[model samples]
Target: MDWSKSKSIFIIVFLILDIFLYSLYLNRHTEAQKVEVLGEKTIEARLKDDNITYTTLPNIELAPYISGSVKHFTNEEMQAFNNHEVLIENETKIIVTLDQPVPITDVEDPASYVDFLQTYIIDGTSYGLWEIDKTNQSATFFQRINNRTIYYNNHGMVKVYWNANNEIYQYEQTLLLDLVEFEEKEELWSPIQVIQVLYSRGLLKPDSQITLVKLGYSTLVQFTQTQVFVPTWEIRVINSSGQQEEYFVNAVEGKVIDVQFDQSKVEEDEE
Candidate 1:
């Protein structure tokens, strides 16, 4: 009766459905291509272009934490090598490599990374969380004292490194096992105030741009068995030449730590 009419109608409906599906596939493909091309990018930053006056800050001294009480341990006792491929050379040093023969994802959260470190990389010692720099997939831990975080980049801290393959390839740990709290709370200076001090001292150029204003502990006192650490604000400024320079201000004492101080400390660390 109407068989020919029915066949034509069916073919037309299927054609419309196929076109709709093709449109959806194309949209998804375009989005995927965009993400692939853009990749992961960092946020650009610049320094403030404003007039400022720097005033000297009164210095406040801090007593050393756990002065003269250095705990000694063999390399074997220090590194937590529980079925993990690792190398330990001293009490305050550890290096571990990825044991699994598979891809590992870059760890974003600092808390979770610390836990992994504690279980697989560290042994018999606990640490305080400071910050995680995701660009390099590196995690830096500090010594928590009296509610203030002290970041001794080389002398008394643990830094973990992840490779491009997202594998936990290497990590360096040097922590103060015995940290005593200060009697009084520390008075920290704001980043803006520190920036002004740097500008007035001719340390920061007027045309220089600041990339980051971070607060952490400066490198530890070198060669002192009983080393002390101070709270510091780090100003990362990019010059007009596109060179990045890091300026450290003693948060409590109001002075610059300088790059030489850090370089010397890092050179001294065996790990």
Candidate 2:
């Protein structure tokens, strides 16, 4: 009788239901993708084709150490202690007295003092005890990445000075903060790859041999909001006349960056 008509109606209703369900599924999927995109860490990278694309992935966040013990100096205290600040581009200079005078004997043991500094004073996780030179009455800690130590006078450094009275009179630190590193450090270009890039860029001389390659952090660019340091490949090369030259390479982007050395510090140290 009307069996054929009922069957045709049933088929159309099922098709409508299928289309509605499919639309709902697509909407949910699109929403999920948006959430994922928001949570991801994205970096712009130039491809071989000379086009930039966002490489989104998880990354390691390395921030400067500011402990609860580090208190901001008040105006009266600054005046009393003779505080001075010299601001230069991305670098900030702060010379203020501590809440309590730190003793030299407390930090004379290099390793233990270094640990204390990390917990209370210095920022960044890329440092290890390098040397304790009593002649200068100071301890020198070098910035490091794994087993590879960064070249001298670059990256985060802590130079703490103590007096004959065993009182830690002063401490100096140059810190690069808020660095983003590739979670999969394996993704960084190898030392050989960086060397090739350097040679291609006419930075490395044919007669020069690379002396050391260290992984560290270098300020890529500075923003008003924050300072961003890139995971850097610091390579030192020695030439015919025994001149040692250092070059910096961005680990993630594989590009060479012009690094400015603190030559004044070198000269001062020589004095």
Candidate 3:
């Protein structure tokens, strides 16, 4: 073998292999750094950069010493007592009358005459019982009712009643039985709930604060709205890296709505 020729070939092969291994190491290092940065920055920060907004509603305050019962009635009975109204007799008597008969179909569940009374009659009457004058076609209370009022309208199938002591009373007459059905009302999502969602999804850091804002992005520019419906501090961020990435963050509740590459930013990076 020619020693000089063999040595030259070996040197060339070693150089090529060294270059390939170095390239692989550099790529792996870059990928690991990207993952670490992503884990640290959070989705909330990314959303803030994008200018999305979040909002929250004020809490409701309950009244003290406010209590009442519920009533239900059949359509036939309500119809029978339509012209004649029920009256409550106590220290004061209040008259309750129906311009038209209440239909059984209008009443919700837990059916009973008392349910109808609770629903239609306001509270604070001395006499608990009173009779409707069917012949007279009017409801008369023997005495004035105390701390109570009655309201009724013929437009809806069910009538709502409200009573006030310290608290305000509210009621609504059902316009159409079919249109309105009773369901358990649910409370709105709170800010804490939002945060939990984001954190659980690995979109947010538990220690980081999130700001909600309206974001508008276009081909020419991207900007955030000044007003935030939810209480939050504005945070400004710049992505110094050439790669374009997206983050998902919610204001009212910390939920990750989306995450993706920003096409415009990518184009800018290329340019």
Please report the candidate that would top TM-score against the real structure. Answer: 1
9, model 2: CA deviation in Å? 57
What's the true lDDT of residue 191 in model 2?
64
Per-residue lDDT of 246 in model 1: 74
Per-model TM-score versus the true fold: 0.54, 0.43, 0.19
User: What is residue 149's positional error in candidate 3, in angstroms?
Assistant: 23
Lowest lDDT 10-residue stretch of candidate 2 = 262-271
Candidate 3 lDDT at 77 equals 43
* Per-residue lDDT of candidate 3, residues 1-271 (tens digit): 4578646654554455456336545654343233223356564565465443334423422111111111233344445444555543331222345554344322222232344445464321221222333343322221111211111112111223322221112222222111111122212234434333433444443223343322211111111101001111112222333222244322212223332211122111011
Q: Scored by CA lDDT, what does every candidate get?
A: 0.52, 0.48, 0.29
TM-score (C-alpha, index-matched) for candidate 1: 0.54
1 against 3, candidate with superior lDDT: 1
Q: Number of the top candidate by lDDT? A: 1
The segments of candidate 1 whose C-alpha lies over 4 angstroms from its true place after superposition are 1-71, 75-80, 101-103, 107-115, 123-149, 161-164, 185-193, 207-214, 219-224, 238-244, 259-271
Order the candidate numbers by TM-score, best to worst: 1, 2, 3
Candidate 2 residue runs with Cα over 4 Å from true position? 1-126, 129-157, 161-168, 174-186, 261-271
Model 3 C-alpha lDDT versus the unseen true structure: 0.29
